[model samples]
Target: MEFREDILGAPYEAAELTLRPDDEGAVCATLVRRLVPGSERAVLYVHGYNDYFFQTNLADHYTALGFSFYALDLRKYGRSLRPHQSPNFVRHLAEYDEEIDEAVRIIRELDGHRQLLLNGHSTGGLIAALWAGRRAGRAVVDGLFLNSPFLSMPAGPAVRTVGGPAVTAIGRMAPTRVLPSSLNPHYTHSLHKDHQGEWDFDLTLKPAEGFPLYAGWLAAIHQGHRRLRSGLGIDVPVLLMASTRSISTTVWNEGLRRADAVLRADDIAAQGPRLGRHVTIVRIEDGIHDLVLSGEAARTRVFAELDHWLAAYLDVPAIEAPLIDAPLIDARPADARPAGESA
Candidate 1:
């Protein structure tokens, strides 16, 4: 793996790792880094569906709090996508173990970071939680941080109950069959600069309409959710953050900018405790699906809550100036069950 200046430019570098290929052909994953020299702690960020590591400000925030930051674009994603491969397609979520394991090796063995935090967003968050659970009782990761994890289907539980089996059956027979996408463009509109937002990222990497969702991929996600509902026994402190409200709609509206337009926030909050014995849930009012991409006021509150939580639970020193002066929206411990019940 050779690291070179990334598309994001100076201070940011990306390295590509070759992985064992599946039926679709050659595979690779990209690890992007912004190292803070001599820092002993690091953060490994995983992007959600139709997303990549383009959040420079997020890296900066971690670096400010004394950590080397790294983000992974899993196989067939952003920097790793090749013409021969399907976009973000995996028959089983465990297929990501190849690159995530490599990334951990590089961060801990090569870079020599002693403490590592696993940070993930949306679908990536689900992957991270399950991955951590699989690594339970091992000291691979120090903590887990999830930003709006896709713990439950946005269409609600009934659809998942009835459709999961059908999707899995179709996936087993024809894994490559594409399903109609349910992604709304308004969420993209709320984030991209060309639209109504302030951030500018490569649209090709994270298209407004998103790529096709395969039956196999959806089936894999359903399986992951099932595993979460049954409990994963993740043995680490966890921090789960999301907006207080969810707004699911296809049409563009001002509310899309301030609320979660993807997964349901209530479902996320309800499912978060199932992750581990020690989990903290925080709800940010007026925040979008990605708390980091929320408006200024809400974003500040999100960061403030994060900073305080890190200092309180993970032993990280708090910043001198708090990001927000308002009362925190919510901070509660999850009553974890040995085995979780169905949603």
Candidate 2:
């Protein structure tokens, strides 16, 4: 493992974990850490599809609450992407277990953190939930937090029930085949400072058009969703959050600035309970798919709810400032939106 300054630069460190490859050549995973010296509690975050660990505001929020924060950019993603590997491609969702295992080992044994929290967004959320369930008796994680977890196909019931099997079959026959996707580029536009929002990140890693959705990858995701639907039985307290509403549109609209333009919020809320018995769900009004990256007002609410849940269920102490008020480490000019609107 080699530590280096992250893309956000200064104070933040990213550790590269090299892993053995399976027919795909060399691969690696990056552990982005905000080291709070002597901190016993830590949160290991996982990013969603076509995303990475550029959310320094999230790390600051956790650090302020006295917990060290670490985010894993899984193999073929962000800092881990290799020139020889397919970007964000995986034959099985379980393939990520190797990286997650190594990350948790480093955090628990190497770093000596006793209490570890697992936080995941979108596809990462599904991966984390499944891993926790698989490790149920091992007590690897103390709690789980999911932001807009992709529990089911956003296409609705027919796709999940019928089209799912067909996709899986195609995946087995030709795993590398690209699948048709209807992702709207406007959602990306709404999040970047260069476009319509406040955050600045590498468009190459998380492009506005997004990486191709391969048949194998889609099949793997549906399989994970099936496992989640059957119930995970994750033996830890779980906090699930999503936007109060979902707006699916191909064209840009003001609603894209507030509501989730990715996964269906209702789907997230409905399937959250299947993760465990101690699951609590919160719906943030006017929030985006990634709650932490939502507008200031929405993020404030998200942090408040998170703090309350952590205090009550995980026995985490309350911090004076539940949310970070300072500007993001990588400060960028805030793009003006309509009055009362926030991204």
Candidate 3:
């Protein structure tokens, strides 16, 4: 269906873009800050599994820091949806290189920004890390920021070791096939309609579907884990943000609101160093699955840390932290896009 106020349940009208692969067909996509001019630096944000970019105020977060912000609703999600494609599906996560490269190409070329900050959440975090480990990332961006990113698999030791390998191998032979029960309901209330969060995205695109778990996707994630755990030779710096704790996706409780109820924060805190030379790890106590989208008090902490860290490292002066207080861009609850920018 079309990405309308009623259809996508967004806080703003999403602008559509097509990322055509040099080697394959064009993929559907979306860019958040196309109309505004930008600075030498820009952030290209990628969303996690069963997700898309909907929060415009998130764009303002960077813009307020004097950097232009650009977020992509990657293929098969948000405004990029296709009738035939799954919400989020792939045999290998590396296959996303096309979308990543093209998205950067669009931002860098169109906005002509010199520095590209690749920001992501959840699975998108893993994708960003893997991409930054590549040669392109060496020359493309200045840094990376991952929010509640999924690094190592969250399964138990036995499943992670034996079960993962066996299941992944079976997946390659049957890429399009679905694994049973990909969705976990325990965390659903955290993002439901009555939730306290600031976004109002469509559940269909974001899938409340469990996201199909085919063999290729599992193998791709495992490959990323191997590469990251083995140590990536990236030259740029990386910032990883996670909740102070973790809760299982299967266990429903208030703890899910206060901690990352998906991936293990300790694993990320531990493995982040292997991703590159310059790595900074920040843990948000009582943060939710997506730190930025956590409760009010939690968000305050999230922005404080972000502001302090960005100033100390990027040399950016302290500006107002990101909040949902700017002008309304659409019909959803509350969202804003930061004011003017460079280029």
Highest lDDT scorer: 1
Show the lowest summed lDDT stretch of 10 residues, model 1: 330-339
Q: Model 3, range 177-266, lDDT digits (tens) per residue?
A: 666654566565676655534457666666564666666667777877877788877677678788767787565577777887777777
lDDT of 3 at 22: 25
lDDT for 283 in candidate 1 is: 89
Error of 2 at 291 (Å): 0.6
> Over the stretch 1-343, how does candidate 2's per-residue lDDT look in tens digits?
7778887787888888988876689888999888899899999999999898888888888998889899999999988998888789998888899999999999999999999999999999999999999999898999999988888788768767999999999988998898877778999999999999899889998999998888989889879988888899998999999887889888889898899899888777878779999998877877899899898898998998899888988788986665544332211112323565543
TM-scores of the models, in the order given = 0.95, 0.92, 0.83
Better of 1 and 2 by TM-score: 1
How many collisions per candidate? 0, 1, 9
Off by over 4 Å in 2: 321-343
* Sort by lDDT, top down from the best: 1, 2, 3
Q: Candidate 1 overall Cα lDDT vs. reference?
A: 0.90
Model 1 regions lying over 4 Å from their true place? 327-343
